[model samples]
Target: MVSTRTPGFSRPRGRFTGRTRTPAPTSAGPSSRPDRPRLGLISRDVPRQRRENTFPPTPDRLNPAHLASLRSVQLLGCAIAAGWAAAFPIISDLPNQRLWGAVAAPAYALAGLLCLILPRRFAARSAAAVGLLGAVLVPLALLALQGRHQSEVMVVERSAHLLLTTGSPYLQHPVVVTDYDPYLPAMTLFGMPRQLLGNGDALTRVAGDARIWFALTFLACLLASWRLLRPSRDRAPLLPLAVLTASPLIALALAVGGVDLPLIGVCCLAMALAERDRTVGAGLVLALACTLKWTAWPALPVAVLLLWRLYGRRPAARTGLIAVGVSLAVILPSALTRADALREQVVRFPLGLTAIRTPAGSPLPGKVLAGFGPTGHTVSLALMTMGGIGVAIWLLARPPVSAIAAADLLAAGLAIAFMLAPAGRFGYLALPVVLVIWPRMAARRWSGKPPVPPGPVGRRPRPERPEPALPRG
Candidate 1:
């Protein structure tokens, strides 16, 4: 060895040869390792890679001025909605007057400011709870203002009395008992809850009953919001929840006992159940929603989509079964008790009415758009119907099983289209429509990564070959 050749050079190592031999890698399968290097941030202990992925190339995560602008817009909407709600109180003849109107305006303004200042830092559930608490106390405040003897429920008492005592739901004259409207029977049946509460003056009893229903509606919406906003076990971020809960339109809707509140809860529950593969539960919740309001029928496509996804391509039969069951559950008892009454009230009443007035026209953007034409209701409804059909098709065409984001978009879009409906009552339209849309809009904004390019199904990515080990010298 000392003669010149090195120890290993003297004789080739095991499995190697001196005559231009090439080495093979020891491992057969591809390396189970990431292609990229990880970079970590020292001070914060936060991984730089995740932070970079979430934030765009822009220097600021969220521009403070942009957030302030959003807040300002929301405050303006709150003011307008509060003013509208205060100036004209429909549903019940209760008057809000300027004092309560002022209360709502400032309350909403402050609430909106809070939302603005916090950005993504705010606890939305807590804020929504606070808002709901304020809404519940509104009735008590109104009771105190109007005196216990003069309640909003009492306003409708005379009409309620005629139905309760004589099996009729309406009065022929101010207080005269008559069977002019058959629909009164069903209304009478539903109104029984109020009658059971107490025997007070007509206005007091009627107002009290309405108040109770309204309160229940408010509570339902509040709870629904809380549930929707709760942190999921997956630890997925909830930007959608924040956007929805913080929306000014939703806040305004909660200010009054808006009918859409219960509908929102029902729809949310239905979607949640459907997402969990609880078909029957979803159907029943949707049916309950239908009984509360006819507008809930718009969610039929979503229900059908869920059914199809659960049962595969041959889903029509299953969907039909669910539909028949839910329909029977919702309509059977009501039809039996008040078939004639419903016909008279819903059908004949519209024919008899010479005018359809909004009390005051709706403040929502949809109303404004429809107002361009004389037959706003027809036009608005047409647009909504068309949009709904389109959305249904799209949703069904590509049913998402694990992706809540896709499902939420479909539901929320439908809700917005409904608000754009020309005939929607102001109390009914604005809030629910906005809540659904806000989440989707925010999600689109927050998702920093670009959408993935579509690839052929089942195509496997090819491995990149390693560079030839530089020819050893």
Candidate 2:
């Protein structure tokens, strides 16, 4: 330079002499600096671009081994369900029992074989198709062939007729030959459309069978539950979905036309909605379920606990009030019109000393207690109540953190209640047990994560995080 330095430059001095001179600002703006480079938006995004491409997208298809195992289980379940439906004719006093068995056994066997051999997607669809056909056709065929209907269906149909004719479903029917309508007024309402058009003939009643309604509704619930419980990481939850949809108990319920299927379906839907945080919808559906039967009662407390954990006490209380209000709205008119009848038939009769006598052959605690007479009934009732209460407490104390967990907790509670119940059906445990266990089995085969070790109840799990790297010298 003439002085070899710009106006504000300073040369290094003393021990810093080996270092370059410090640069200073000239008349030129900061951009004129030679040592500094400007970073544009594109340059700044380079690291982020690399991060975005660091890992490949997760696979959409399930592991083949897992799929095979799941398919095997599904085929086995479908075979059992089909066999059960087909054998119904032989087991019961129905016309063409052997013929029906012959037809149904082969159809189900062929469907199961098809599912076993087809590709996974097609297999799932075929299994679902077979299940739907079985649910609808088997029950209708039974209704056509059998002389007597399931006791609950008979009672419901009779109640609907009574409601249409005399405006009091709770009143005993003269011609329908049912002992009593043990269901809530809501059930009679469900049967009214068909009853109104019918001349009270078995054919017309069968045409608008309440079991069909229950079966269809149950299928809808399965679809909704499958959608909700689907894992975020997995694209296809085919295995669990098939297990749930084609459950033998569900098929049996559809065939027999039991009132429990509708209640179970509603309860499952409510749980799914609640898990999705659709509080209002959940409350309304839960209220509707409560109106159908007492089997859904335990879900009320569980729903409340879930809402309380997710939204806090106030919202939970409000949702609870909404559920109670809806239930009262649906039930009160009938309650007011026939308080004595409703109380005696819906409440007292089900809990009556003789209720367990119908299923005396069952191996449950209640069934076993039936042989001991009134004292045993009383003890069974107390134990059942205590068991239900204990399960409720356990759920409230720890509250499930996810939908699957909620289903498991709810299923456990219902199972305990049913097992100890004075008049519980073993069939009542089927859907709940399946909902609780199927996912666990599927998860063990499909999930890549390590299994969580069992911990004490009410303990919150801590998340594991990686340690920070130390700076190098």
Candidate 3:
């Protein structure tokens, strides 16, 4: 028949047909070809850093809401940084703050502007990274190397020394604001590293700086809260968290002082834990925060209200009992042992009643009023008291049933207190601002998802009805 199998390789009759043989795959060692999938063995040859960084998920790019959120954060952050940069030279004479404002802050603003102005959506993440590096990491490194930090660092470290030597953290009589340890006893723990490490070298000095400990505490609590809010193993909102940390509200104080950071962070953690119904954990965390600073005390009642409004009396009782009990146990012994000293440093000094003038030179209304001698001081205190009464009434009138409501209420109270305090820095306001923002951001509820608003006490909230789809013709 006309050679039906006409092709060249017609299995050369008897020569090649005894048995059919299959050819083996080409010896392309695992992942040798660029198109081939990497095997476990092939991954070994890749650089550790390269392998880890390679193929990172670009979820933000895919999600428009998330990308828009990132841009908004960057834009807001840049504006704040620029404002700080321009104002520092005029308002603050502190060397560290001045240096950071001149160098780091401008760099941060520039990076953010460039990133935002670019047409590329992918630039958002790169911009956040760059901003963080320029605004926080680099400046922090410089400060540590130069052994130049805010006076609060010295005060904290000195308190640690006193704690070791005399079982108390404050001086008997203080000559200046810096001489007084204007913090609770628990704050002394951050200073322990410096006392133990002995600032012998640059590295040691950096390691010994109390700011490092303060930063670590804040970062730890923040990460914990993030985890508690989002339980997925891989769902760490690290990028947003980093951006928040690098924002002017945090980075400026963090670079120079950051004494309040640990307290702020722990308080946030307590709220997150309580929201999840982990009463014991929440109580303990709140107790830690209360011990760290008096500012954190307001958070306790707010948290208690949140628990009570949500789960009922049992959970609220458990959290309040643990928080109040543990914090008292920590505070009372020290308060009793060194009553006069603690009063001078912790109470009178902060209220601007001390002989030594407060170094807090902010032109805020409270500070301005307090600067005008005794009458002004009394007026500021009275106003502050009235503010507190107002907030307390509001708290009782409408208890928060949701985490967002709780946070907002607490932040409002703190902001009022800070603004009305006889002796307070402009920097202190960061705590309130951060409290309002960080919790929502950590939960990933801001910008993308709306948080549940507080409902009537003892009544279940109505479920949200989904919007009807658009009808097609």
Candidate 4:
């Protein structure tokens, strides 16, 4: 042993006498093998930092060309809307004001030029802000002008007054305007607060300025829609916001003080709520919208579909019931008070034997078809009905998987209705178009990663199991 055995090897005794064994390694004072290179502090820390789940990775920025295009389109919309709104009051108020309508064209062109000269990076936000400001200011300015011109606002004001005093808004014809109180009873509610505060002063009554109220409401709706529909981690909501805020039809509708804005607002809010899984709230709001006008009726079926998809058949049926109850609660009082008159005015007037005329700048295919007389009108109506039915069937066949999809389908249904309507304003199509397009654009931009599908409401996701460790050599 002294002459030949290795230090770590031992000769076996007794039963193991025939074999020699090597001793196992003892304490690891240092690696017995050759010295290995050490990782520096930066290299060690970097991987450790990545392993920690404290921070999320940064999102990619939008493309420069896409951003620029978005900004340009937004600016153009804002400029046009602002110019149209500014010109509307002048043209409508002054005796020979139609001449001033031409002034808006040049003003819009100049605004567009100015917007183009600004830095491209900030252009969309700047333009959107400008448009939003214009939307607010233009209506306020019109209200302040106190033009005393005959408008839908006057109809609402007078109807509200008549409802309070004469017990029937349809009994007396409003001053100079003669469509016979086609508005729903809930519409009078909006005008009542201001009229009731007037204390019977004629000037105060006429100055109720429902247009201002409607414009403010519409603005709020646009903001809410933008917030609800905007994609996570994206900053390009400006274009969609601008498109809605700066629409010429929307501007015109606001300028004219039409009652359509409230309907649009309520419908939009309902859709937003439904998207957020607030089924009961959405149902209540949708009911409120239905109380305002017939415009929201087409959305009801879509709402049902959304509820069914989100919460099964029972909840969907319950929501529909709630909606119907709310609508009846609002509508029944007026209907009971003046059943025949309300029916004739609200229903007969809108869909009577008389031929309906399209709005002045209507671009509906129906408008073109209407030029061919009775047969054309019939064809237009039939086509519109068929188209609407087709869309409904399509929706039923392929139910939407998300709130955004539901909205798109609902908007599509509304668009079909607007296009087919025997009489409709171009503005009627604006909300639907924006609702359909904005979400799509946002989705397209933020689709770099596949979205994590949401779990059913109130349920937690299953946790993933840890992987088995790899064997070391």
Candidate closest to the true structure, highest lDDT: 3
Q: Could you give me the TM-score of model 2 versus the true structure?
A: 0.70
Which lDDT tens digits does candidate 4 get at residues 45-153?
4444332322222232453225436555646565655567466556454331232243334444544665787786565555555554444344435443654333566
**Candidate 3 residue lDDT tens string, 18-130:** 12322222233566345322232113555554444333222444432365466675577677777877677677778898877876667777766876787566566776787
- Model 1 scores worst on lDDT over the 10 consecutive residues at 35-44
lDDT of 4 at 22: 28
- Provide the TM-score for each candidate, comma-separated: 0.56, 0.70, 0.78, 0.70
Compared with the true structure, the alpha-carbon lDDT of candidate 2 equals 0.62
RMSD of each: 11.0, 12.4, 15.8, 12.2
- Shift of residue 395 alpha carbon in model 4, Å: 2.0
Error at 333, model 4, angstroms: 2.5
CA shift of 321, model 4, Å: 1.5
Evaluated with TM-score, which candidate comes out highest?
A: 3
Off by over 4 Å in 4: 1-107, 132-136, 148-150, 172-177, 199-207, 226-243, 355-363, 438-450, 453-473
Tens-digit lDDT string for candidate 2 (34-79): 6432321113334543422222212324443354447776687667
- Provide the lDDT at 310 for model 2: 69
